[model samples]
Target: MGIRYVSYRVVLLITKKLGLLKNKFPTKPKQSTFITLADWKDTKAKFLIESREKLNFPKTPNKKLKEETLRILNGEICFFSYDWKNIGLDYNWITNPDTNYEYDIHLHWTDIPDFKKENGDIKYVWEKSRFAFLLKIIRFDYHFEQDNSEFVFTQIESWIDKNPINQGPNWVCSQEISLRTFNWLYALYFYQNSNALTEERFQKIMYVIYWSLQHVYNHINFSRIAVRNNHAITETLFLAISQNLFPFFNESRKWSEIGTKYFEQEIDYQIYKDGTFLQFSMNYHRVVVQLLTFGIALKEIHNQKFSKVVYDKAYKSVQFLFECMQDENGFLPNYGANDGALFFPLNEYDFRNYKPQLNTLHKLLTNENLIVNDDVYDDENWFLSNIKFENNYVPLKRTYGIFSFDFGGYYLARKQNSFTFIRCGKHKDRPSHADNLHLDVWVKGENVLLDSGSYKYNTSEKNSNYFTGTSGHNTVSLNHASQMLKGSRFIWFYWSQAQKAMWQETENEYVFEGIISAFQYLNPKTIHKRKVTVSKNEELWNVVDEVSFANTDSMQQNWHYNSDKIQFHTIELQNDIESYNSSYYGLKEKGEGISFSFNKNITTQIKYVEE
Candidate 1:
């Protein structure tokens, strides 16, 4: 049988078995069951496509975090921490849901505080690990006092036993926060020995460990789902493997088989062949690095040999991480608000060292070349390639036919001295940017046709005109319609691919051409041709689209360019529009190729590293 048929059948079988095809991708996840208490409002989410959109100072906000950690340590949050059991519960009933799911409810980041209002304004957000890590510091600062032991147990029990809790739902078995609870319960049972054991606690501990292993470490469907990368998914994978905690859960033979099953397929979802993970956020990339460290430590502790696939993938993935790291305004672009606690001191240590992006890790290297130490940062791309239309996707069968093209743009070093990039794609997608096939080049660091990035997610009403829709990007705006697939879910999902992205050299100029399929409704035989040329002599670039939508009407197209700085350009439209942009930062021009310019001298060179 042909590899395509065989490979396709494999995916088809898996999806069929999982029943995933039957389930429509949710516009928003049902959080009442998984995350919080209620559905969010348009007041909160501010789905921005309505506005052309109008559009951060951070210097290791770590010092303030350290101070708070110290306060929690001194027992300040709970006045006089003498066995919190005595204190009547001020906060109770996380929720008393009518629906039922039996929950042991071991809290993972329970140490952190929830959303709080201060001085008539919402200030500190209740993020998962950041606040939780601080709480652990507070507890440690007290030196594990004997008097406070009751307080910890009572509070943890009350907190954990709440009606609603968060852990991926694999409801076939009992619904318990099995992973974190295992650690919590294990820590207490073996506090004296600092190791979880004893014949009595063994079986129960095994059950929890079994659940953790099944979710991320198993071959079944339970492992496929993910939140942000820092949702502690990677940490869950490593906790079992690195702790040599396997025997306590399952036997040696069974453990090895299951362990191999967990990673080989699952890792593909995280690390692309180019070494990038699906989630584009930088903080998550950092999380992946730490996970790799734990994975290595795991192999040694368990004395098990990982498959060559896992070893080879991890090594190559590090290369991808280093390539994506850059010096934006000094820190990685805050693509989206990321809230995770530092595994170490942030001011003094570079988190990148945890899985340092050097060509190879050395025995002699002491500290890491911090994300801060790296001279480049890209506000444009949060991760390597946010959402990819890639072929040559995997499996040796069709590697030759495999092609990877991104609507999301990339950062390139021109002549190895300056940085220029193209920004396409959004971890969140929109229908109204001119940046569909838009190429924004910053030859030697100048704001050329660029991506007009988002304004705000929290405060929507006013900023809407500036951040949402076609005018925010650099693509050709056909009518007021967007080039993207619309609706809120479109912001998060895609259904098609870009084909024939051939990169070639014509002695002095660089050439790239591909066909972008809007990923619309998956009707067969639909194609849109896009071509981009960057000339060495012109020191200029031109992008053209001969896009033909097959049997579809009123489709919109746009190109977007995002940057820290805004560009001043007049929209000299040759084609007339029904109406101009209703909001700011958008255009209403409808037609074929449109040229928007930035009067500046720049250089964009395209060269490839020999594989």
Candidate 2:
């Protein structure tokens, strides 16, 4: 219907010109510090403004919105989102709450931050001591120095308490990290099942802060992409509209001045000016440093104001989340941290931020006077400061004109990952084990070629087909099971309709590369050809493909490497026949996505002027 009302009003005018709505922030009292609260009673805030005026939903009004935007751009649907799945990909099943979760065995213990560290960074000290042992064994009710004084709970909890009172996606958050980790661990087990009362734990913490603002304002603010989505879940949804949806009611100064002007324009346009969080990641800067250490411990237990430009922009976003860590192995760099969820120190390698309340903050991404042992990372004045945290930053790439099989773009740009992006995208009538324009390197910020993530989809889907192909991606592949899009690709519709990228960076000495195309269903008369070489004697980085297809002939150039951490060092061919030296396999994830392969026809070799 007029291209789905011009693609849902061009994605709400690019999320209202990218400030992504907090109603668009900046109310001033000297640009805010939030404390003003003069009075606020506790009447249970009409259990969330009468459940946000009974949210009737169905707003296709304006004359039934051009026949409901041609029944949602011809993919017709109505009543409560049709068979949904566009990007929600089940969105991590509310913390994968055991549908009888199975496993024969996979153990490798010792981690309370590596029992006390030796050389750290074995993947952030085994996932920050296995997420502090899955939040001390499924959150709340604790005690066990080898067993004693009872207080139990935890079967691997925290998908915001298996999120549901309004369907799931982990029941999205807000209201200050849904009152400290998923509706205060389910309203502190409904105030210890009503026994520990202070008015029954403040009326089950105002019914879990009015059911987390009717499940994040009925999902309109689950932040589909607004208010930069997760800055410690929008500061625990503005600490649940300032400590339990504003002192639990009595009209509460006209809905707490319209939810404090939509959380002061969603923390100044979802935070920036150097608070760094345009969606970049260091495991989401530890959820924006525990949501600014729980709003600095709820402004010391009850003075909640939050201004000083939101406490110096959440203390320069915890010093840009420890200066976006990277030194080959100081750890952290995965750009988008997305593996199975339930994070309670399963082990990434003795996670270290260095104590003494993170020593006022100067992290530079760990090394705080040594401890980790195995992967060996000692700091000895490693602080190296001039303030240039190796910024190559890169985000302004935005072009997307073609790719669902019609060649590529007139030119290209195809940027990737802005914070934690990786729906693992795809296309071609709708293909997707994911590989459109195929990108995966990051450089200096670390990540040499990754994407080989997903493992067990069914016998680990053929060893995760080298991270779903085009030879695991840095672009150009004419063989090795082809692949650009087909089955399993998340629905994009437009996140740049599946690949057509372009890049440049060179004064000379060869650093530039190209992709300008990717996306095909049928259309090939000759080969496809590809190249990305760099090895002036082991600098290591190569891939070249040349295919020919009028009637297929002689072509076999497979160069796959699965182990030995990658050490081939050399290989070149112009026209040959027999070739064998296999070593390719995938599915060793923590943050998967690593690929490299060049085997097909042949006709791509360039040095041009300064090799």
Best by lDDT: 1
Q: Name the top TM-score candidate.
A: 1
- Clash totals for all models, in order? 54, 71
* Whole-structure CA lDDT of model 2: 0.32
What lDDT does each candidate get?
0.35, 0.32
What lDDT score is found at residue 351 in candidate 2?
Answer: 41
Candidate 1 residue lDDT tens string, 139-179: 23232332233344444443433422222122211112332
Error of 2 at 297 (Å): 34
User: What lDDT is reached at residue 464 by model 2?
Assistant: 39
Compose the digit string of candidate 2's lDDT tens values, residues 1-611: 13544566577667656645423321111211122212212233222111112322222123233433333333322211112112121223222111222111111110012111232212221121121222222111121111110111221232323332333222223322243344333223322323333342334334444544433443434342333345334533453444443553444344444444555555555456556543333444455544444343334333345445655556555444433333333433233322322222211232422221222222222213222232222111111211122212222112321111122111111222111112222222223333433333323333434344333222233443544443443344443444443343222222224232233333322222333233244223343434453433322444445543423333333332223343333344332212111111112423322223334434333211212
Candidate 2 matches the true fold with a TM-score of 0.28
**In model 2, how large is the Cα lDDT of residue 516?**
25
TM-score of each: 0.51, 0.28
